[model samples]
Target: MTSPAELLALYDSQQRLVVPEHPPAGVTFEVTDGVMRVTGRGEGFVETTQHLGLSGGELDALIAKHRDHFAARGEAVEWKTRAHDLPADIPQRLERTGFEAQEKEAVLVGHTSDLLVARPLPAGVVIRETNDHNDIVGLSTMLSEVWNDDLSWLIEQLEAQLAAAPELTVLFVAEAEGTIVSGARIEFTPGSDFAGLWGGSTAPAWQGKGIYGALAAARAQRAQQRGVRFLQVDASPESSPILQRRGFVEITSTTPYIWSPSAPLGTQS
Candidate 1:
């Protein structure tokens, strides 16, 4: 049995603070003072190691560097922080530096074999894997309907991921009566033991009908096929409990602290 601590250790060792060896076109990766900064594509992201051995002043300077990096390009940046990360005050530091905290999410991990078990789907609903541009666009449309926000970024991101590494990314959708009701994806980490199962968005009428869990299982099955050992999800509050019930171990919490130039230092918006 894989303990939560063991899984978390594995996650932190392999997934945390990674540099993109083959960054997709228009993207650049930089590592400075234990932080990996990803820039381009109109948005930036910053990730740091679990143990950032820095004094308060050093950490503050590092945070300011992140701010300046994005501010120069006039683009927003999302600083990814995990609950167990050190200096132990990184989230507060981000906020004091004008980063707005987004929704906190549960970091869930489970063995691929554990989630590979077949699950029941709603009547007449079928989970299908897709790589077509049309299906990708349709999935973004259906997801926007569920979240009531334009998910145009999803389409571009998915397409970019697929084009960058077709073998590493796949899209899935749940269709009922020929209409898309749910969407999901699996992204295999090229050199890691984990595959990310992400984006389970279901129609309001389709929620709680087992579509979410079914989509998860489908993606897990894909992970198993890829010889991945574990599946991971940064689950929203609404989906966290559901993923927990499906055998994923709750490891830690994560929140994205976003900052843009319009929101200057010492303020959040």
Candidate 2:
């Protein structure tokens, strides 16, 4: 049996590499010296996933350089600093400066082929395949409405990714009355044994409907179809229990630490 702590470590290790190789297609990164700064133009919901690898000083400078960009556009950022390889006072620094620390979540994962995805969903909820721009746009729009984040960037990235690697990725949506209620993206990480279930979200009016879970199951089913063995996600508290109920286990907690010179020093939201 795999312990949660061990699983957490595995998740942490896998996530640490997310910045290096598999950054979201919409985000852009610029490296200077030993620092890498990542910025998402329209898809800047979680800054932690966007930017990786910067010393304290480097982060401060990057924040200063991009302060106007963020402010001009009125984007809220959850700057995440990992607990490992970071300053002890990083959260304090973030708070002292300006950024707010939000709830921390554990990365959770399971065997794709082992997940029992046939959970009961609320009535009128249906999962369906999405391949065109309109369907993709609708999914993105619903997610944005749920989280209040822009989806144009996320949609653009997904479009490019789906175009390039159709075999490795599948995007799905849950709908009611022809409007999207929940959505998820399942990516079979190329050249690896793992497939990821990402961006699981449901509309506010549709909570407790199991739409998210059903969509997750659909993604896992897709993964099984592709012969992948592992399914993974960085889950918030709300979704963690859902995954756990379906056989996913908690891995290590992943805290994203962030700093910008013009704003707070360290913050995670």
Candidate 3:
């Protein structure tokens, strides 16, 4: 069992390393006055803020810079803020600077051993790990239906990521009658003992049937096999309690402040 403090420390350290201040291929990264800005093809984000002591005017200017940068590329940008981030007023600043605050999520952490308990899947449901394109498309489509949002971008991103670094990413899906009902992906942090769980989605009809727990268990087993130490997730309120029952602890909260070119500065709507 890993202590919360230890898990948090691992998270902080691994985050800085895995999520680099520099841009990866096909993305742009810029750092100004200790604020790191990243812009991809369809989205952008602000992170790695070092000088949280900046005045309101400076913060506003920083936000505008990122907005214009992403707008040039016709991309919507998100400023991801964690509760433990410094200066303590960053979230308020982002809200005041035309960034609409999105849903708040619990950052859950747990040891792989704690989540690897054997659980029987629902009758006729089986979990499979795959890097195949068709399987990825099925999983993405299921998630799109689950969240009621277009997740085609997810398919593109997953295909590219798996092709570029197969060892760093794994896709898992729960299938019934050869159709994906629940799906999730795990990403391993190179040179770190942390693996992140993302896109945990189950069909509405499949909810409360222990399908998610089984999916999580499968990922945990894979993580243990890879010698990973900790598993982390940004869990929604609905999923937080379920994760808690599996030994995951809420270490902090994270919220995304989004800015679009169409929206006026200092206004959410």
Candidate 3: count the clashes: 0
Better of 2 and 3 by lDDT: 3
Clashes of each: 0, 7, 0
Ranking according to lDDT, highest score first:
1, 3, 2
Task: Supply candidate 2's per-residue lDDT for 180.
Answer: 82
Task: Please give the RMSD of candidate 3 to the true structure.
Answer: 2.7
lDDT of 2 by residue, 1-269 (tens): 66667655555544433443445455666555433455674423333422345647655555444443555655545555555434355456455446656677766778885564566987888888787888888888887887787766667877877876676678888888888888888876565557788878889999886677678778878887777767878788888887787788765555653333355434333
lDDT for model 2 comes to 0.65
Predicted candidate 3 versus true structure: per-residue lDDT over 174-252, tens digit per residue: 8999898988889887777878898899999988898888888889998999999888999999989989988889887
- What's the CA error at residue 123 for candidate 1, in Å? 3.6
The estimated TM-scores of all candidates read: 0.93, 0.72, 0.90
Best by lDDT: 1
lDDT of every predicted structure (CA atoms): 0.84, 0.65, 0.79
User: How big is the positional error of residue 85 in model 2, measured in Å on the Cα after superposition?
Assistant: 4.8
State, as a TM-score between 0 and 1, how close model 2 is to the true structure. 0.72
lDDT (C-alpha) at residue 88 in model 3: 79
The collision pairs in model 2 are: 8-251, 8-252, 80-256, 80-257, 81-256, 81-257, 94-266
Top candidate, metric TM-score: 1
